[model samples]
Target chain A: MKTRYSFGGDEHVYVEIDEEMSLEAFFIALSLRNAVAEAEIPGVTEICPANASFEVRFDPDVIAPEEIMARIRELEHKAEVSDKRLETRIIEIPVYFQDPWTHETLMRFRERHQDPTGSDLDYAARINGYDSVEAFLEAFHSQPWFVSMVGFVAGLPFLYQLVEREKQIQVPKYLRPRTDTPKLSVGIGGCFGCIYSVRGAGGYQLFGITPMPIYDPTQTVSYLKDFMVFFRPGDIVKWKPVDRAEYERIEAAVAAGTYTPRIAPVTFDLDAFNADIAGTNANLMEALNGI
Target chain B: MAFKVVKPGLSTTVQDLGRPGYFHLGIPEGGAMDRFALRVANMLVGNDEGAAGLEAVFMGPELTFDADTLVAVTGAEMPIFVDGEPREGWSAFVVKAGQTLRFGFLKAGARIYIAFGGGIATPLALGSRSTYPIGALGGIDGRAIAAGDVVPVGEATTMTERSLDRSLLVPVSAPVSLRVLTGLYWHRLTPACQARFFADEWVVAPEADRMGYRFRGGSPMEFVDREQPFGAGSDPSNIVDGCYSYGSIQVPGGQEPIVLHRDAVSGGGYFTLGAVISADMDLIGQLQPNTKVRFTEVTMEEALAARAARRDRLAKLRAALA
Candidate 1:
């Protein structure tokens, strides 16, 4: 795809690979970010990779904005043929669907939703042609998701389903963003799934809540002891739905600092995955269950 | 040396140049909103340009010093008081042990910078003393200063008092015009809306904060209808989630346009029409609520020239102080 490069004021260069979101577009953005970082270009301060595009923030005094754009264009050319294999880890995130916390939060913001009469999960299930919320929930947890980008807020991961485009589940954001979203609320908007890393204003349609701490700046959690952010751009996430009782048990464990996330390292080959999407996902899940 | 906060004014926090390179992880490069003012405050006290200092908004903190120290206050135009005796802004002054520093109502500007001789000695998080309150990182316990908090200060590296000439100061005035370089998703808006964006006058909304500033009182913008892209929301103003640059202006539903600031979210679904130039972001920081502003569009060349001009002014300020 032909990428569009635009300057963000005087300090940043935004490169949009595609108008639509896709794994291919994400890979291209990732490769470009990696290539620019490896080049050790001076004055380039931050390389932010996103769902279908990426941004590079630079110091204009050290390197002219045009010069950085020229270098990035050159780097993009080189990245076209680079290796596509990503060595990443798969993590199991325990979530309690239809949990009371998110349910109450969503109910309060129903005036801003497309369907105020029904819950977010029910509305999503109906629009996606599901007979019941249970069937939709099954479809959601059965497939693993790719951590396409980690942003919007500190440690928040935007997840893309591993399934093909035709089978992708999509939903629109709130008509107007709600002023409040409970922290750790598992929500979906458009074709992306996310966990609110902190309590703040949000627009996503909340369906569940995650007991695990995906972000901890103090590094208090055992799983996040080494790093404050639990999810990286290349990480794969598997949603494991649990009952309310299990959610409380895990929540208690998390509060006591005894929770350890289930993680397993795996290699993701873009070409191989593209060739056999279902087969590749099954293999990846096998690795996760084996751990 | 240290200072005891007898009264923590409306949201005071420690800040420097902030920690960069973490925006990818969704952590904003948070720091003093009025960076030029912070740099000047530090320079007046003989501290490093990026040294940590107190960034107070609307009001100033009542701090009592434990030891004699040189200090300077900048950014907002407010009355500075030392033990009930009026002092001066934009100049370094001596605060003896047990003397309390205070301020009167803010006369102009929204935020103020207070720099000590050796800078605030807050522990660094991600190599910065700047506070990212949303992420609970840096500053005093990763939050704003409160009453009774004993703020620490580094040992006095230099004790000389220096002041900037009144003429050198960047004046905060009404109807501030911010230069914008339109890009990112500028094509999404209608031509009339695009024209209206620049032609309309906007007032700073009360919702303004470190994360972003919202501007209202302008005619609601209209978007050119199109087939919504896959994975994007149905709203005409929504796009596939993407990265947001510092100073990027996002107009959700074409209503109030919000300009993301220092502690902005790294990425979001709302479309950004353009970004306010880096040269004028400091001015935005000093704008108070109800302040009228205009978004003036500029070409890339003009934006670069403005940046160069700002750098030259900073150099002149540094030289004058020296």
Candidate 2:
């Protein structure tokens, strides 16, 4: 596939090796470079992901819209060739599942979606291809996807993606977010799981608690590293239930500094974020000129 | 020499030019909220522009000099008295050992800048003497100035007395006008809304701070409904929560515009409607709550010209001082 993109009067042309190319990633890289190059341009800024995605900023005057689109199309092609398969790794994270009401609410939700013959646990196990619900629950304690949490001081948010029974479960938005969500809350909202790092008002559904400290200003490195986000675009994830003892072990490992966080494979292009912006800018310009 | 703080006022903190280039790690560029006043005070004290000073918020402080020290006060128009004798603003003064410096209520403006002949010597964090109140990173223990805390002053030698430019003293009673440039999401507003933005005036909101100055009274502008974009790990709904470079104006809900200042976050998720011109940031800093502000959009070229003009002015001032 071939795609042409432009932004800020800059032209970018690129080819895609496969339809699987992730536009977000491609643009990110392009934007980062452009933002850096145009630092001197008023209103132009760029953000670079030392580890995840690339970003760029530009002054509209420094580059033409068509030029940005061309760069996007060109970068998309480069991303496709270097594309890596989406992979998921499970590392056990110990969480206390605070506030019994939160668990009750999640259990009720599971029952609402489960088949009549199976318990909520059975349904969850079946979705991940477990022969027995108990076994699946046991394994869950040893492995959990590390969600990406981002926010301000003591304010962290995690993103999660799960797949089951060849059907994608869409997480809904919170009908009414609480004025203050508790810290370490396992929340499900809008097709993702989020762990609240601090006490703040939020709407995501609470599932459980993880004793892990997601944010600590005193620490040298934060809990959320560049590469360890739970979901990155196309990666598939599943939740496994773990018992209290197993959870404790993982917690100890985290505290002892014995656990090494595994990095999730890159499934999306890091360059497409800029390309998409570039492409959109070009299209807007073209439509304006009736070309 | 050291000065003991008798009263720390509303929100006083040690500040400098701010720490820069560490946004990726989620650190803020915390410095004097009012750079204009800070710079002028520093210049008067024969300190570098980036020298650490005191940022007195709202009401001013009551301090006593433990030893003889040279000092200058700038920024807001707060009455200053040495041992109960009123003094003029902008001119350098020497206080005898054990002399008390008392400040009266703020007559105008929100912040006051006070600089010593020798800058305050505080521990540097992330390469700045500015205080990041949220992270508790810089300043004296990452907290605001407290009563009884003695601040150390650097070594200094007395210089011959010279007259200061009287015209440079900004009037406290008058309103300040700020220059602005349209930002990334400026085009997202409707044509009529865009036109109204420049035509209308805004008032400084009560919720203003070092992080940003929130404006009130402008009609809300609407943009196309879109999912909130992600920023550097802060609030997904507010882009300014992440990292905001100097002069970025982030408008949340297409309503109130928050002008990011020296203590602003490194990145953010809010829709940036426009940025105040760099040269005009000082003018904006002088504006206090209830101050009427009108935003006039300028082109990128105009912004550059303004910046060049500021640089030239600074050069001239430095030459005159030399």
Candidate 3:
């Protein structure tokens, strides 16, 4: 069942539906098509979607805000009730951290106060079990993670989130602030991990890079689009690392049309997922002690 | 039939309606800044509303017509001449093959529209001829018009002299006042700041283009530096950059109003203080440097009415043409 709610003298409307429907993307797309067809506005513009919200631009002369809201509600209801399953594609990207010292520095800093006689060093040594740094780098590089690249600028692609444990990796706030960050650097910042496509003033910490070009204007749809990064709410992902040699090999295979990113099949129950979210929020609050 | 560009203006490009259905990929709807003038020029030459035309900015171009063609120049007051004869603007005239069309200084406004009976024959890129120069998409070579470039003309059905009317021409020199509606963030402004915004006049700053137009005003608008993230499922902060929407008054860092234009980005960072009503976009486009502009707030009802009136006026003109 779908429920319709109106706000701001009908300037805005939202349709809440049973979680079973999983039709948010469909509803948004339908709204856009209906706005273009039913509203006789001159140059009706549609804003790119941010998160789950998408906006359509119309000439108020042709259709009132109330009318637009009404149409959206109608479309949302129809989409919610429709018995169609949307097709989604998943993609895997391999990341490589060129500098091992960054992780080593973090590990050493975390252990310094705990063990005056280097007992923590044993723990660190246990964690670093590989014969050599090169062996560790190679071993870590084989894991694949799901990534969604969204926007493009200057032949570079921008992504949304890095998924883990059937949910997005929630990044904690930075301990110390850095003013500038480099492009293609992946880092976690405030509940999200992102890959910076270009050098700019940013907050995320530097992690690593993937051999795949973020964007290439020369290609018909660009590699970002070819990867099928189209994402919806409630998707799951995991991260995998790769070495520079393997990255180059994968790049070559992609160029030769022989490589495809590994994807994991996803299945979920909407009610159960929503319940999990509620329980997780409660737990988070309890753990934080009402901070 | 084509035209040879002798001297392209500061940032001239070919434009028509715009590209659609690609916003999910971060492409902008690149089109004419002053759509009213583009329509008028198209109407004069018996072309469809979305026919490709020239959007010459800041200055005009010196060109030589390769074939006998009926053309009209509209938008902004530029001193134009044909074969050294003083040429009247806004009206269509036949240019004989091999005749030269030269433009002098720009008297007012930033962009001028030039429409030929046969529109420019540039290949449709992403369903538009409008140039998105930043992305190198659409128009001739995905860039502004330059000297020594030859643009081909499309096939056009020649009309009889009876179809041409001098009365159909739109006056290019008239001063325009734009109507506006307060947007979602309008109330975020302090009462005193709002009062100052409405009371004082603003001038078009030197930094104005298809992407955005910055205004020189009495005082800057300040806002709390809250960490406002782009809404859900949005691009990372950087790729989704630049202006958006006509009349979208963006105050980045609580200073200088950057009014977005036709070729604005899909999403942006700055606080969108206001969006100008659709009907007033052309009026805003016609403003010249140092031109005084007052920001008058109108109710949503008034905005709708103004939009209807503007549409009705255009419909009447189209009916007259029919």
Candidate 4:
């Protein structure tokens, strides 16, 4: 892949690993990101990894911008040939599909959507060649997704499907952004799936709301006790569609500080997964079920 | 010591140099919008340069100090008054107990940094008192100051009175020219649009805030035609979700360019044409609503030179105050 390096400003250097978004592009960016992190270069204040690009913010007073760029170029070359195995966690997040909250929110912003009359789920299902919402939901939950990036808000994970590019679900964002989005609303814009970490402006087509709290400044939840922000880049996520009652049960448990997110530790090898995509995904899902 | 907020101004928050190292978590390095002014106020009050101070936007807060302490107000040309008596801005003075510090309507600029002798003692949420209101972290319960709130003040180790030289202050005027280093998806814009972006003058819209400053009145930019990539939006200006650099300018729909600022969202789908250089960001913070501005393109080398000049100027400011 041809990596293009550009200046964000005097203090930031932006590195684009590829012109398009793909798992290969993300891994290349991640490899470079990990290398830069482990190198512990002085004056580097932030190392932000995105879908197919990464940006480094540094204190120019401590290190010159040219020097930082040179160091990053050298590191990128090394990262391209490095091992691509990621030891991460597969988290099962329970979602109440077509929940009333997100449904109401999406209805209010229908004018901004492509199919204003139909529900976001119905529209997405129709466009993705699924006969019904159930089939669409099945396809969504069948494969685990990689957390390609974690941003746009605190703890909000942007996910890309682990399946091959031919099977990727592609959708366009709203023509204009809506002023409001229900917090924890599971939304998809383009091919990335994201859970809205906060209630604010959004343009993604909302499908449902998650009962789990992915973000909390006050670490009230047991699982979030160690870190207020729950999601991280490279984490895998599996969706578990739940009924309203189950969603309410988890919500109450979360409020009572007794709920812990379902997480299973896994080592993901890029080469192995590339070789046998279906078998690899089945094994990953089996691991989640075993946990 | 503590100071009671007699009347909270429009959007007042405690801020410092800001908390870095959290951008990857989607938390911005939010602090005072006018960082240079904040630093000057801190220096005048004998506090650390990164000390927490009050950043009041548009209006001034009515604060009553419980104890006698030094204070300085910088940025914006607002008239500072202590118990109805006027005091000089950009200079440190004592505020006695039971006296109230207030201000008249803003004469110029947008934000004012008020530094107490000892910085605001708000509990740190992420190693800094700077408030990121969206994330609800840091600074007075992670929100802007309100009436009846009693904000704590740190102990002043060494009180001092200092005044900044006129040249040291940030200069603000109507129709400012902001230097931008155009990169990162700049190739997406047509040559005509790129030339027009620099040729046309723009005005700051009311949407300007800590998160970003939206500029209007510029000719709508046109993007080069291309087959939309998978996962990217259909709009010509839209790209796949990616990281937004601080000061990055993104024009959704190829109109109304918005420059991401201190409290910017880390990543999004909007394609950024380029970013305003760091040296010019402080000026963006000082711009008032409807302020006319122009975008002037510069090379990376020129941007770095400007940054170095700014650093030298700040060093001079510190030495003069010292």
The lDDT leader among the candidates is: 1
Each model's TM-score? Answer: 0.98, 0.68, 0.69, 0.97
Candidate 2 lDDT over B93-172, as tens digits, reads 88778999889988877788888878998888768888877666678888898998999888765533444576644454
What lDDT score is found at residue B221 in candidate 2? Answer: 79
Give the best candidate by DockQ: 1
Once fitted onto the true fold, the runs of candidate 2 whose alpha carbons sit more than 4 angstroms away are A1-23, A30-93, A99-211, A214-291, B157-163, B169-176, B225-244
Q: Rank the candidates by TM-score, best first.
A: 1, 4, 3, 2
Worst 10 residues of 1 chain B by lDDT: B166-175
Model 3 clashing residue pairs (backbone)? A50-B232, A51-B232, A51-B233, A51-B234, A141-A241, A141-A242, A143-A240, A171-A191
TM-score of chain A of each: 0.98, 0.47, 0.49, 0.98
For each candidate, report its DockQ versus the true two-chain complex. Answer: 0.87, 0.09, 0.12, 0.78
Judged by DockQ cut-offs, the docking class of candidate 2 is: incorrect
lDDT of 3 by residue, A165-194 (tens): 333332322333233444455554333345
How many Å off is the CA of B197 in candidate 2? Answer: 1.5
- Model 4 ranges off by over 4 Å: B158-162
Of the pair 3 and 4, which is ahead by lDDT? 4
lDDT per residue as tens, model 1, A1-291: 769999888999999988888888888889988999999999998899999899999998899888999999998887677777899989899999999999999999999999999999999999999999999999889999999999999999999999988888899889888999999999899999999999889988898999998888888888888989988898999899999999999999999988888899999999999999999999898998796
Candidate 1 at residue B151, lDDT?
A: 87
lDDT of model 4, residue B71 = 96
Q: Give the per-residue lDDT of model 4 (tens digit) for A186-221.
A: 988889999999889898888888999888887767
**Candidate 3 structure quality by residue, lDDT tens digits, B1-322:** 8999998878789999888656545566768888878987787788897899998887888889888888888888898788888766776777778988888898877778998887998988777888877667788878898999999998766642223354644454333344555553554577777778777677778777777777776587744334343322121111123224446676654566767777655444334556766667777677776776666777767777776776777776677665
Interface RMSDs of all predictions? 0.8, 8.7, 7.9, 1.1
